[model samples]
Target: MKTYTRITLSLLTILSLSACKNEEITPNRGKVKFETVSISSKLAGRIEKIYVQEGQLVKQGDTLALIDIPEVNAKLIQAEGAITSAQGQLDMAFNGATSEQLSQIDGQLNAAKAQMDFAQESFNRLQNMFQDSLVSQQQFDEVKMKLSMAKAQVSGLQAKRDEVTKGTRFEQIEQAKGQLDRAQGAKQEVLLAADERYVIAPTDMSIETISLEEGELLTPGYALFNGYKTNGVYFRFTIPESRIYDYNVGNTLTIMNPYTKDETQAKIIAIKQLAQYADITSTSPLYELSESIYELKVVPTSDISGQKFFNNATVLIKK
Candidate 1:
């Protein structure tokens, strides 16, 4: 009877010890979470098209939507016309007066020359008459004045003709050319703005949320879509502040998805210096943290396919 009692006591103690050992071996597991960001529109216009739907996977530079660009196109065309007109004016200014204009100025100059010659001959005859006392000094003086006026008119006409024959000044031509170039540049800028109406995907991203739809008038800075990288989803988890001293960058970790029973091996890429506290009332459960927890970034060593890891999903980590 004594032996039997001793055996029974030993068995009970062993069982209790086993239970304590089991409790000690079980690790502290925490839920997995993801970070999200929202993408917004850069320009304001009507949504002409939406190329992506909710949960659609997209690569970088993919067109997401387009704005109505008819107005922009019209402005570009108008600018182009203005540029053409400016260019033609610039060309004319640079080329100077045409042959026909020069010819007309030349004829006027020749007529002035003929008038001056006739006046000079008359003045010479008057001078001879005055010297011989055949005509009065006042008559000779009148003829001399006529000759001087004709000579001055001829000189003025010759200068005017020379000006017409000379091509446009270099400075004036350059100014006109610059105006035309500016107009052309304005047209190009409008075209570029029109092209910007179409929104494009950034790269290798999955569309998480779509806010706008076709034909909707979107204002500037409107929320368009939310996206995440598709290659490998990052698992955001936190470690207890007590154990933070033991963990460092490049530390290996094991993560398990409790929902899917999927396991992934990862490494500690970063340890957030600041502590994250709980916001219990918020709808987002992942960001809500308990006190004494520090945020951590873990990148999976392997790929996860078709598995939806819930925010705050349980992960079994073996450090």
Candidate 2:
């Protein structure tokens, strides 16, 4: 009987020592977090209005603020004018010359022909006079030059008449069409710039801040840090190297919501060794001097859905 009692005491002592060792390294809960994104304007502008306050829920493409881009408005006006002018030029190319213009050109050509005839008759008379020694060589040459000038004028007028009647050349029409296309493209570009006037949410998130007040300038690449996405809720747990053996990339664990006391099964999505010490946001940071830490990314399983989790909220991980 004494031997039996001694064996039972030894077993209890071993169990007690094991319990104490496990207690020295307790499992920790990570924070419920959603990815944060920066909200910014592609074009720099002054804020016209703020539509949201801090902590407001917004969906993707929702207008958070309005920016007044003075340059964009002016560009739109210029683009529209260019489009109108290009359209007019294209129409002129297609329609050719008007009836009045054709009639005027024909009249000029007829006048040129009359002058040519009169000059030819005088030249013939001068030729005869020269042959009879009735006029100087200079006089004959003067009449000959007048006839040539009249003939050249008639030819020029005839060419002008043909061009007016034949409409615009193929090259001219193609050039006009290209100009119209260019104008339309410019107008589209201006409209896209105008769209940048609204500061928009990139995803479904809660507003974390409003960096600028009304009438203040907002430069490019500024972060509004719209709070984490609601639908893409996930938890990030920082586990020190001492306790990292409990988790891998695909391990499943039950996470308890500290606020609601509700438990949800989550699967580990990713595991990464944190490089920076300042990035550690672990519950029970286990402030060791120089030991490396790791981060475990987890998401709720499909069987557990529809839970609204808040950012940085405590969630116990059951490893």
Candidate 3:
């Protein structure tokens, strides 16, 4: 009975020692991560339709959603009308007055000259009568005023004809050109706003969340889509200050998926102290309260293009 008791005690001792050894060699826990991104609109509009759903993978330039901005359409129409009016004004400046306008000015000038000749003749006759005492002072003054008015009218018509013959001034033409350019620039801006109605994917990414549904109003600068870049996978580990010296930036290490037992090579790209307790990414509280925690950012050394990594998934660092 003593011999059997000794053997049983020896077996228990070996098992206990083995279990302790396994615990001591356990790998450091970490998490798989990816760089996140948010897509937003530059202008406010109602969501007309969503082309992609959550968890859908999208390529660069893909239309993710369509927005209904009725104001944009109206503004575009206004821009077009402004452009047309500006163009017409510019053409008029370049072409100047038509032949018909010049002929009309000439006809008016001829009529004004005929009236001036008649007024001058009457003024001369009144002057002679006044000298002979045949006309009163008031009558002579009235005839003199008529002659002066006729002369002024002839001078105004002559000046107008000269202006029309000279055509538009250089300054006027330049002003019209500027107006046309301004109108064209406004139209370009409106077209750009129109393009904003279609929300496009800036890069290849996986959609993680949609902030609004179809028919919902989205305000300017509001993030409509939250997603992750397709090739932004990495690993994050929180290490207490006591064990931080074991890892350094640029050091190569083996990372493993705890559930799948899959392994990959990675390099420690960064090591920074955590500013807050919430910043720690470790699954379990494996450090003391008084100890400072640090984070390790690791990037895969080998091509991980074919591997799938989920955000916040459990990953381990192999020693």
Number of backbone-clashing residue pairs for each candidate, in the order shown: 6, 0, 0
lDDT accuracy of residue 19 in candidate 1: 84
What tens-digit string does per-residue lDDT give for candidate 1 at 50-70? 888988878778888878756
The global C-alpha lDDT for each of the candidates, from Candidate 1 onward, is 0.78, 0.85, 0.91
The candidate maximizing lDDT is: 3
Position 254, candidate 2: lDDT: 82
Q: What TM-score would you give candidate 1 relative to the actual structure?
A: 0.67
lDDT comparing candidate 1 with the true structure: 0.78
RMSD of 3: 5.6
Q: Which ten residues in a row have the lowest lDDT in candidate 3?
A: 279-288
Per-residue alpha-carbon lDDT of model 3 for 146-240, expressed as tens digits? 99999999999999999879999899899999999999999999999999999999989999999999999999999999999887888999998
Which parts of model 1 have CA positions greater than 4 angstroms off? 1-37, 104-164, 274-292, 303-312
Query: For candidate 1, which ten residues in a row score worst on lDDT?
Result: 21-30
Q: Which stretches of candidate 2 lie over 4 Å from their true place?
A: 1-28, 115-152, 241-247, 258-260, 276-291, 303-308
How well does model 2 score by local distance difference test?
0.85
